[model samples]
Target: KLRERLKISGDYHECNETNSSLLLLTENNTSLDLNISRDAVFGNCLDLAVKKFQKRHGLVVDGVVGGGTQRALNMTIEEKIDKVQLNIDRIKWLPREKNERYVIVNVPEFMLHYVEDGEIKQQLAVIVGDRKHPTPIFSENISYIVLNPYWKVPEGIVRREVIPAMVKNPNYLKKQGLEAHQTWDENSPRVDTSWIYWEEYLYGQKKFPYRLMQPPGPKNALGKIKFKFPNKFSVYLHDTPTKHLFKKRVRAFSHGCVRLSQPTDFLKTISTFNPKINMKKATKRLKGKRKQFIKVKNQLRIHLVYLTVGINKEGQVEFRNDIYNYDKYQKRRIR
Candidate 1:
């Protein structure tokens, strides 16, 4: 009875002729048939499973899977079931309904999706936060978009990354297209740069001597497009100039911001559901210096989820890696 429950039929041959080394499962003197290649099972299978899982979870449907998918699949069956239950509990985390059109960013899968009229219209690769700085899970309406916008260096980035680099090379800021403005104290009064050497600041004996900002261009980290929404976390979705990163199967290489590979496709998809704005007009508006905020007619649902094990459209149970270690955590958390 236990063997039957685990699908341990003697006739099962868990090997594929195309790839002889691939193994799906072996139990009760029987081998389980595999749906994907053997190499795919351990590596790409988890990646593909993650993509399928992400699609079902209302995320981008890209075929390449990464850390988020690995972490999700590494979860035990009990943990996965718990995640489904948690999703049910947090269903209210999303808006009751959206403007008939909207965009969703799934941090785990590092992808974004555009949906309209209950159908996925476009999908794009995205760069999400690393384990140290996991992307926040939230949802909000996209009020507008900014093209060629200047980057306002975040305070956290300045203290942790930029300031240290500046200390080593005062010219580092200039090379990265950053310009230094006067530094201010609590009184908002300007502090002279000559009084304090910028290089000594790295030793922890000095303060950040100036405000820095990177101008808009190809070298700008924010890329060419930025999607804006109303949120307290100061998080937003945007494009990245580093297009090469998308080629990786497991892309988890970003600060807190979400980076999309195909912003144009996403823009077009969002405009379709937004009756108030047409794609042509939106494109024209983006080209100009003036920014535009086109409200969507229907808000699209967005979900950032992690699923380690799942059934594909073909109804095969798939496995994946545990990238974020979410599976381990979920197992401990779930009773």
Candidate 2:
């Protein structure tokens, strides 16, 4: 009955390389007249259309009508209506008061919007957190910017990741330009790697005394800059070395911190709020090898929200997958 109302005609056929070749041809930028065929055999035109639909819907662009794609294609009008209503309720929970300017990161959409006077001033793609390391939804103020930033490896990552890697290869720290410190203090003494027992650290027999830090450089994981905000979660927005990940439709790669696609441009936009922020000097600082923290004159409100369905500027109902399963939880509550 739902499928009949939605007019979902047929199940997506098993994709083949022949159909994928047609998909490649469509991407060639030359127009090819491939007639729409009946047999539900994924043809060049249909495959290309499916890919475009997937791209627009923020799904993985594999050109294959798999489970995820099939589910999206099969969504009934009633389902979309329910999602729209639920998102409306979610919006009501947010503060009704408007700020003069602010930053909003919609997690499911994988995008950030900088707004002023209720108008969008700037927008960019962002990589949010995955399920295992979910990005928290909350409001905070972006207080400062760190140029040529060093990455203070998170304690959880250090325990779960760094120690294991070091156990396999002791040179991992040196090769990655990372250093271990006895304490998180600015002037903490550096720990000599040779004296450390990797197994003791990994096995929890010995406490890892040092905090792992990567010095600011081309290979730095935090890229050239970081936007600081006060949050109990210790999560902040920053640039990343993995810029290629931003091109993907579903960008939930970060542990918790939001990774900006265009950090430089984002910096410039926020810099305008405070007269003290000098973009000239800031850009110059980005060239330096040392990490420098620059406090902005005015703090901008930044909200990390999980809105899977929204009404865009054109007033079209845009939907995205519930990357964090917030929609599923909300649906259960509705029931």
CA RMSD of each candidate after superposition? 7.7, 6.0
Candidate 2 local accuracy as lDDT? 0.79
TM-score for every candidate vs. truth? 0.67, 0.84
lDDT of each: 0.59, 0.79
Q: Write the per-residue lDDT of candidate 2 for residues 217-276, one digit (tens) a residue.
A: 988989999999988998999999899998788899989889999999999998777888
- Please report, as a residue range, the 10-residue window in candidate 2 with the lowest summed lDDT: 24-33
In order of listing, the candidates' clash counts read 17, 0
